[model samples]
Target: HLERLRALAREVGLEAPLYTCTAWGGAAVPAEGFLPMHAAYPFTPWEPDPSFEPVPSREFLFRSPQQPAADWWQAGAFRYPIERYPYAYCELGAGIQMTYLHRPLVPPECTQALAVVALGSGCNWLGYYMYHGGSNPPGRRGFLNEFTVPRLSYDFQAPLGEYGQLHASYHRLRLIHLFLAEFGDRLAPLPVVLPPGASTLKPQVTNVLRYAARAHQDQGFLFLSVYQDHAETADLEGIALEVLLPQERLRLPHEGSLRLLRGMSAILPVGLELGDGLRLRYATAQPLTVLHARERRCVVFFAPDGLQPEFALARQGCRALTVQGGSSAEEGETLYAWPLPGLGTRLEATGLSGRGVELLVLSQEQALRCWKVRLAGTEYLLLTESEGAAWVDAGEERLTVCWQGEAQLDLLSYPRLPSSLPATGLLEDRGTAGVFWRYRLQCPPWKARWSLEQPEPQVVRLRLAAEALEGVRDLFLRVDCVADVGQAFLDGHLVADYFGSDLPWIIGLKRFAQPGRELELILRFTPLQANAPVLRYFTRERLPLPASDGTLPVTVRAVQLVPEYGIELPWQE
Candidate 1:
């Protein structure tokens, strides 16, 4: 089959630089010069085996196989020599989707931690499966999804949702991507050096720290993973790691011991080059990304929830300068700095050559709002926490900022200031009470009322008077339900479908429903089995299902008409 595919590609006038095959799933032999690829899904909760190993294909690093079909390692069974091809991972599961048997929720922090661990484990290429979610179209045979999969919705709770909504994971993973984008070339050929007893450490052992480094020429990144898969982890205290550099062996923190919070991971710098004139001795806080300007280069770093933001600098004739937003203390030749709590702060210093090096320290919450964008052939970093819609046009040199529900924008870092501001008046905040239109269901014909709850899986016909949707431009029906699946219909045609998760189901009604006329609406629900064995095994404490009498307990939460507001900002090069 591999020969036939290669032949077909040649016949079709297609040439490829690299040939690869999936090395997992009962491995088969691949053609010579073809690289074998495997997926790393450490956070998957429904795996049959959860043990950690040390092999490159199964564990994390590449090792040459002794013989073909060897039972000693999982990848050895494929009869492929590890030295013949480069080891890479093409599919790392970023997050999991809902299934009939298992519904696993991947936290934002866990996603970031697993990515760091994969890199530390000697993974060369980092790729993600289903970074964004999508909806499934109707199938001719049946629903087209797996028997255990959701009927319509395929929102996998990934970094990007099915509706292009940005989750917290998006921002968290962006930090890692930005770092890789800047420093990946220097880290590509480095070899992984694991600390002793890392491979033999059991999942239950929380005292032993897991640390690894990818070093070339004595300068490398120290990867630390305090998170364990599917196990409760304790906080690691009094943590100190010894890193060997070209000139000397340095102990991190340079003062007191540090703590590693449970279920958190970080990649710290060792002998990192800050610029031509200075180098970073060591740092406890993780390096986020680097920002380059015309005059100077800035390195951004952040501390975890519990750890202190402390780092040392080693340079010739480098003196510490007073920073406006943070405190600094000088000890001997090394200078240490710390940022203010809750507020994002910038610390600056001047080297002997008069070159500037700035460090921007931010809390985790403040970092989530940071976005990197390109406008008018220039890059800009924006910090805004607006719930309303916002966009930027590079050609027009304009920024449309939205104001909704106490939304604010702080220009943390930008290339230059805007030339003009919007002349529009401020939009009044009417609160949730003013935006949400609530209704209840009555008996018989399902007439809408002002009170009482309605049963699920039943069609409730609703008529919207013109006054009810007076100034509404875009209307949405929010369904608060605890069901397996839901389908919303209008006038007899299915309009939208939703899969049950922690997020509520929102159906857009702007294009379908007429505002002034009476429209018929139908909602269909599918209840989950109350006695599923997998549900009992997985979620023994919380089932996430509401009590019901053979029918799903779904209710109409609200009819929200999101108001659109925009403010223009004039910009120049």
Candidate 2:
């Protein structure tokens, strides 16, 4: 219970507001990303069961309540939304969605309405699905079912549609955000005033007696599910809605009187109106923000006991701008600015994902210069103090440099850059002992090709000659360059070069290319440095090997997985 959590916090001398509230809704029911979205077309995942029998918990399957109770207790159990219990309300079916941001085409009116309700109720902080769609990464484990998975486009009718096209939903949410820039403060502490006997939508009896008494204020409130389809307009006093569906209205059941009680501050229900006709999928309330606008201004809808902002925007005319103090700041704090002479006329802030902080320069109205900075440790300081101003539009998280101003800023969600790989270490695997060193080459992200520089024609020559030991191939064996880079030999007998080409995932892997018996293997590497330095080396006198049967094959052992290092034996299929 929340009481236990609060007690635990107090016992440890821990401060309140220990955790930020977040929603668990996703494309699937179990709330796990790995789970298949489409129940009908689930991927038969590899189960770790030892009996060779399929494990229900590990694998994906479908179950319906209509089936016999015995079947319900079968291998995989059926799961229904919590809203189905106590009341037969349809709106609380299962799988609800709240649109904080969405793609174009979705009605702006609906998004705005939802935002208003969310703010009125106490929900804050929002994220949308399919923000920017891109192709799925190369298939790994072949565990992902192609049919069920959306194309790399991720165009799930989101604000940023699949093809990078901006849709109505995108603008709708953007406008709401723009408005939130205006009057978000008014709604932050706005309470949901429910009237009279509205007991049907009340928290289920189980959650009330079990979770309500011990709930933590910092943890926020609970979202109770009711077995209702769409929350039609209910004039009854007890129901306080985050969004209103004015277009469609269903009267409250006249069968019974509204149950008016403080039901319990825990558990709210969310309904997702998908496809046409606004058919809703039931979902539990999670801490989230919904933005709406009345006159081209944004207003954030909050869930009761949802997210509460540290500072609300009280001003009316001016647009809300993100101010970064070359540093971190709390929400709703003032920012100050100083002068920067050598660092260009004006310093701007851009690219919040990497480093989570950066500096930029402004030329008139354009972004003239920018720098991507990474923190070496927990924190980094900016010596220069200047005014921090950002162009706070719908989707812009980057801060802009104002001509003159002052402020403090904080970094939220600075996505860390992926770590760098270890240096390539060439190790031998198997070959003629003493004669040949079976070297294995590891490539980094920047290094597209692996190479070998033969300074003395005799080093490789002598190294190859030492192969008199058993299990050693000929000293003058053929050389082969696998993927990407071209191949060249000094012996004039063999020459193969492929430059300016991309490896396509469509063809899988290409194996052992060159054909020759006695040849020296020389590799050439190409590096891609993004505004960074590239180390280089060179050597001379390349030797060649005699030709052999075209039977040698390349084998790819690691497949398409990470560190795709392996022998690429000639594969026909």
**Highest TM-score model number:** 1
How do the residues 1-573 of candidate 2 rate in per-residue lDDT, one tens digit apiece? 444555687799986643222112222133221111111101121223212322212101111222223432233432334222211111110111211111012232333333333332333434343444333433554323244232222234445433333334454454345334433453333333322222222212222211110012211222222111111221223332232223322211111222312211223222221112121111122212221212111111222222111211112221222432222232332222222222222212222121111222121112111111223221111111222222111112211211112222221111221122011122223322111122222222221122234453222211111212212111112232222122333344222222211211111111212232222443232322212111011011111122253211121111111112221111111
Report backbone clashes per prediction: 1, 95
Task: Quote the positional error of residue 72 for candidate 1 in Å.
Answer: 10
Model 1 deviation from native, Cα RMSD in Å? 7.8
Evaluate residue 570 in candidate 1 and report its C-alpha lDDT on the 0 to 100 scale.
52
What TM-score goes with each of the models? Answer: 0.78, 0.23
Kindly list the per-residue Cα lDDT of model 1 for residues 1-573, writing each as its tens digit.
876787798899888997777876547746575678866665443444323221212332212222222432343444566666555767777776766555656777767876787787666677777688777766777676655666666767778766555566777788788778878876777777776655455555656677788887667888887776666678999987888767677777777788888877778887677774676777777776776766787777777667777767774546555455667787777777666633336666777668878776666655566555555444555555455433233436665443222223233334343223312222222222111111111111212221222344344444454434333333445555556667766767566676565566754444455645655566776765566433333333334445565433444444433332334555555
TM-score of 1: 0.78
* Per-residue error (Å), model 1, residue 48: 11
Give the 10-residue window scoring lowest on summed lDDT in candidate 2: 532-541
Error of 2 at 461 (Å): 52
